[model samples]
Target: MTANNELFILSASHTREKLKQLRRTHQFFCPQCKEELQLRIGEIVVPHFAHKKDSNCPQLFSDGESKEHLIGKQQLYCFFENKGLTVQLEPFIKNLSQRPDLLVTTKNEQYAIEFQCSNIPIEVVQARTKGYLNASIVPIWLLKTPNFKQQKPTRIQLVQISPFRQQFITRHPQHGSTLLTYNPTTAKFIYFSHLLFIHGYRFIAKVQQLPIAHQYFPFLHLKEPTKEEFTHYWRFHLHIRQRFLRQRFYLSRKGVQDLLLKGCYGARMRLDQLPLFIGLPVRNAQYIDVYIAEWQATLLFFLQDCQISILQVDDEVIAIFILNNPDYFQDERGKDAILHYILLLKKLGVRSIHSSTKEAIILQLLHSEFLAKCYEN
Candidate 1:
């Protein structure tokens, strides 16, 4: 990661300043390794710092900060600085033994904003996140613009999504949770939230953007999905499911994927006949790869207009009957397969209520599509 120069350099006081004098007199040092640095204030390129010679410092050993990275970082500094907020560039914490790119303090909170221009290990991210947490500082990571890819008008898939990146997902008021990214060049914040998990490393989010200087949202506040918006997203997802049902070869054969394929085909089931309750959204659905169709089909044949013993119809029975593999689930592995839908069914007058009903459940497959139309109206 060899770059000829950098936008700013650190001094003994850890201050970043522009070139004012014709000839340099201040002794600037490398921020990463504490080695002495050389300054180049040329006309063609912006003023920057370079290593002495043939240095191999871990921090400096990156793909070298690009022009976008440098300008983006400086602009981020300006973002807080313009608001008359007290901000520091590369503030070093002795106790934590870490230096964040920018640190700011409000009336009651301290924030460490890291403008991550390059990819780094999730462990490093977690370690730094933990350090900031231990020091009572909130760490906000703003990914570069290139990382957020817009696949379609309504679909924005975040690039390089690992388990660690998934941790960065936070709740937006209307949307359940969102992955946020900032475009330093445009001076705008992009909100990629309201995700519908398709597969591993693949999700489509409702895309919305706002300028950084927005009066109401000085801080990030992505728009929450409205009733109309949520329905539109759900309907689009249904279309996707329709396409998948037509040709299921795109999916990898692993875990319960084959089970879903075999069970649906074996049942001679039509996707149109599937109940809305079958694919009820769950918060932790991302943890398991089982599609909504897989587990939902397990409950289809079991439902009748009769009161049944709840204990006998557990996750194991469902897994065995549908998947032909009872050993797949243990410790209530797929207990949630129908929990929410069952609860909603009762709520929606699809089941008769009984006082002190604990051991038995009365289930009847109400025409869910017709009910969905009624609900939609």
Candidate 2:
């Protein structure tokens, strides 16, 4: 929030001459708390306001703020207001019990924009987002220090992802779920879509950048990956798997790596021999408890124990794996991923998929010429 108490609410830019005309007798107050503001104009600084010494507004609390953040908020206010839309600056929503840095309303739509500059706990972030969503107001968070890099990078500098940052992710109708961030200084938004977790918290994403002024949907999916692009991606994950043996990724507890490696070694499984099936880029793999190599190796050992091959893969067997590997996936997503891989293997004539729905593409593909060769072979 700006300290421009002398200026009007929602419109903070007032010339010193204009504010000087109001004299020392001008009446102003905090927008949220309504505490009286004292107008102070100086020869050096721009005309602004200072809350009276006795004022105690709960909203005044701040970990800290930056000049860029202040200017960005002002620029955004002007950006929306210039569009002839109804906009308010630092307005407190009574019902939601939160004050967004800026709020914009267009007849049928209301949006709360938080110019997020500092990192906060995930719980606090999710709570705020949930509150706004429950109140039927869309919350949009704009990150000031976002990671932007080149070449569909596997990872940016996200040492840790705050809960607030995780809320940036959302799914689309086609391509996949994506994460969004904005750079207020550049007036641009970044879209990180089609995410695939490779190892630990790192991911390979299709990144796109566009100006905030563009009249387009931010969540629109991008094009599918070319065969060569996909091949390169799988190879990248293979490298990540190799790195897992060297202990290069995040595993919460100490000596857990020893348990995972020793468990696989005792099964007479060579980590290098594991197939891509082990670390295949299922979108929900991010929810798995272990990194790629650990879980994938376990799946391979389980398959070997059952004496199963691609031709004999059974859905029941997959369910058994889920039952046995309680730490594999977060929730029902593990089941969905199992089904996806099973369906893919069935299409390749290496396994059989028994989806009972006629409208399902997997079932239809099974009956097509693609699966006919599988049956013949």
Candidate 3:
């Protein structure tokens, strides 16, 4: 048979019927034991065929098909009805761009029910639920299992939103709905609702709100730097410097090395190794700019063919170093150092920076104002 014909046979509902008829009519031989087998149905689990004796049965059959997905629109409608909630199945919701599984409206309150069975991307689900909330509709996520049964609806477990912060909060607590858990064994459902304070109103489902004092300058757990780690860090520092320099100037290996050595021992030392200068706060913008300017100039002196661009956004001066020669700093340290610099610059209100290669440009921009504006809206 062709491939399509085989698939059709495998998916046909009659496959299970045929197996049931065969079991009743014939005394089939045990595939493993080669002895006469007795047929048993609905013996161990839900509707299935099994052997009488626990012999070594090598062959396996599942009605020759995959189980049909049970958590469809109709199933969702029946589920809510079983909960004594009035539901309108397949309600049109424009924000979702698809019909909700069930639209429940009761006593001047309304909610959209979305039953999701498969493991989907978390961000996608968050975005969809956020959109629903923005449209003044509450979204109820009915997370079903692969084997969705009305008698044993799968319960929703409370997952930690921010494990690092030791915080647990439901996704959309303001919607006047709670996370409901369904017990398959006992056929019971439980609801959970709790309030949590989060810094930003971005549509994060499980947000762990750290202490407000550590909001901007979170204490980083530091360990003594190993030689290998220091080498990697220095290499990253060098790569970012070289990339920026190549954007403004052209330099030979000898020239680059000389410049790096000069900056390492000179002004770059004060800013790059901030922990050493304990009396002077590294958080100051002037202090940060001093280091940035020194590093930028060092790159310009070494790489003569590169261009460095700086943009002032808000209280921050963003720097972009474009490198013509890309292979100079292709290690992890170089990438990490550049990213660290961007984050530091952002914290200090020096806006953003872009480090560019021939292929792509890495951008580090702050979104505090943008986030604040989003909440205001």
lDDT of 3 by residue, 1-377 (tens): 12122211111133456657755765554333354544444333333323555555444322222122221444344555555677775544644564565688666667877655345667777787787788777776644322323322312221332231121123331232123332233223323322111212211121122222222111122222233432332344344444544543344355446544454444344223322111111111121222343443343333322332222222122223324224333332333334344444444443212221211111111123111211111
Clashes of each: 1, 1, 21
Whole-model lDDT, candidate 2? Answer: 0.59
Off by over 4 Å in 1: 1-27, 30-35, 40-47, 54-63, 147-164, 172-175, 215-218, 249-268, 271-273, 299-338, 348-377
Residue 91's lDDT in candidate 2: 75
TM-score head-to-head 2 vs 3, winner: 2
Arrange candidates by lDDT, descending: 2, 1, 3
Residue 247, model 1: Cα distance from true site in angstroms: 1.2
Candidate 1 lDDT, 1-377, residue by residue in tens = 11323424322223334454522545656656776666655554444566767877545521246656666666677767777777777767878888787888777788998877667888899999999999999998877655434334553332345665665776544435667777777877777665655545655566777787772313655454555565555565556556655455445355345655444555565544454444544434444455555444445434331233333455555455445434434334345535544555555444321213221221112223212321110
Worst 10 residues of 2 by lDDT: 368-377
lDDT at residue 131 of model 3 (Cα atoms): 78
Q: Each candidate's TM vs. the true structure?
A: 0.70, 0.70, 0.27
Candidate 2, residues 346-374: lDDT per residue as tens digits? 55454211112222343344334221222
Candidate 3, 188: how far from true, in Å?
A: 3.3
Positional deviation of residue 370's Cα in model 1 after best superposition, in angstroms: 20
